[model samples]
Target: MADLVAELAAAARNHTALARRVLSDLEAGCRSAPECELRDLIATSRTVPPARWNQLLPGARGIYPDACWPEARLVVEVDSRAFHGFGDAPERTERRRARYASMGWTVLPVALRRIRTEPEQVLAEIEAAYRAVLSRRD
Candidate 1:
């Protein structure tokens, strides 16, 4: 998908900047607007380490987290209301988090609304977790 966008950007005569920006976000593994916003926050944060979006974790039986610092074993899940609903959705999310936790990964779930309203606090928490994970390794 990113390669296709890059090709389009290369051939496009106009709006190449927009295409390039989209390509950059896609390459960074952003699947939604909220994820992109979180990525931007992490990118600009002083304390939080960079995250790899949607990467498969071998420790979690091939589960791909929303934003993960593989070396730190930390994951930040961007919870959007659009997808989460009544019934089994919440249960599934919890079970997923449990799987990551069982694998010794620190999982942080952040709502889409909070990402827009309290980005600073969110980043701070992520940074704190990142630091704690690294410290444990040391």
Candidate 2:
């Protein structure tokens, strides 16, 4: 038991170190993305694995959104069908959307296929959603 506890503690420390490195890299990369209206409008930010949402929220269905812009009240989720599979995907997504709605969050699910095939359309949708969220805030 003591050995297992020590191993778990070591793993946790390693994970934290890795997370810091990844976050630093992400911040550096973000500096290169084009500066735009959306970038200026962000309020709060967080990055966590989707499963962590359960810990973030107690009773209600907690969903770990891929990316969230809290100031814009937007939650962006990237869905890679290849990895996530396609069985009843839309239905499950809709349910998750409803859950977010119930929590007063605007959820946007960006499919990997669309991102690869029609990036412009995805950008347009994202911009439109941002605008809509902004409008609601006002």
Candidate 3:
């Protein structure tokens, strides 16, 4: 951890005041950075992995998400049927979905094919999901 801090400090000092800004962001408990570069193609506020990342799944400690809007408790997890293999027991999937809902999340699962071929549609749907949750305050 010390080594990581020293390296980050050096890298930040070398760049535009981003070091201090990054440090501040970290100190503010913003760890577990985004997992997907798809963030670059979308417009949103700090779409990073959740702060309470591990809690994303009970009895699981490293449930790092792909993209999440912490304020809205919305997460967009990318799935690829070709790569991940259609391999989850129906009961397991049901339990996981129930846990996510209990955790106050509006989880959005997006297929890799849709993201690669129809990015605009995916973005729109993501934006809509975020907005829907944001409006739940009333």
Model 1, residue 134: distance off in Å is: 1.3
**TM-score of the candidate numbered 3?**
0.56
Candidate 2 lands at a TM-score of 0.51
lDDT tens digits by residue: candidate 3, 1-138 = 567577776674555466555554455444433323245346343333333322344333445455566788776766555423456644554565566677787788777777778877887887778778888955
Task: Highest TM-score: give the candidate number.
Answer: 1
Question: For every model shown, what is its TM-score relative to the native structure?
Answer: 0.86, 0.51, 0.56
Model 1 over residues 91-113: C-alpha lDDT tens digits?
Answer: 88888888888888988889989
Q: Of models 1 and 2, which has the larger lDDT? A: 1
Candidate 2 lDDT tens digits, 1-138: 455445545675644765544343344232212211122222221221111211233234456555565667677666666424578876777787788788788777766666567666666777778778888889
Please identify model 3 stretches exceeding 4 Å from their true place. Answer: 1-37, 43-62, 82-84, 89-94
Clashing residue pairs found in predicted model 1 = none
Model 3 residue pairs with clashes? none
All models, RMSD in angstroms: 2.1, 9.5, 6.0
* Lowest lDDT 10-residue stretch of candidate 2: 45-54
Candidate 1: where are CA atoms >4 Å away? Answer: 6-14
lDDT of 1: 0.84
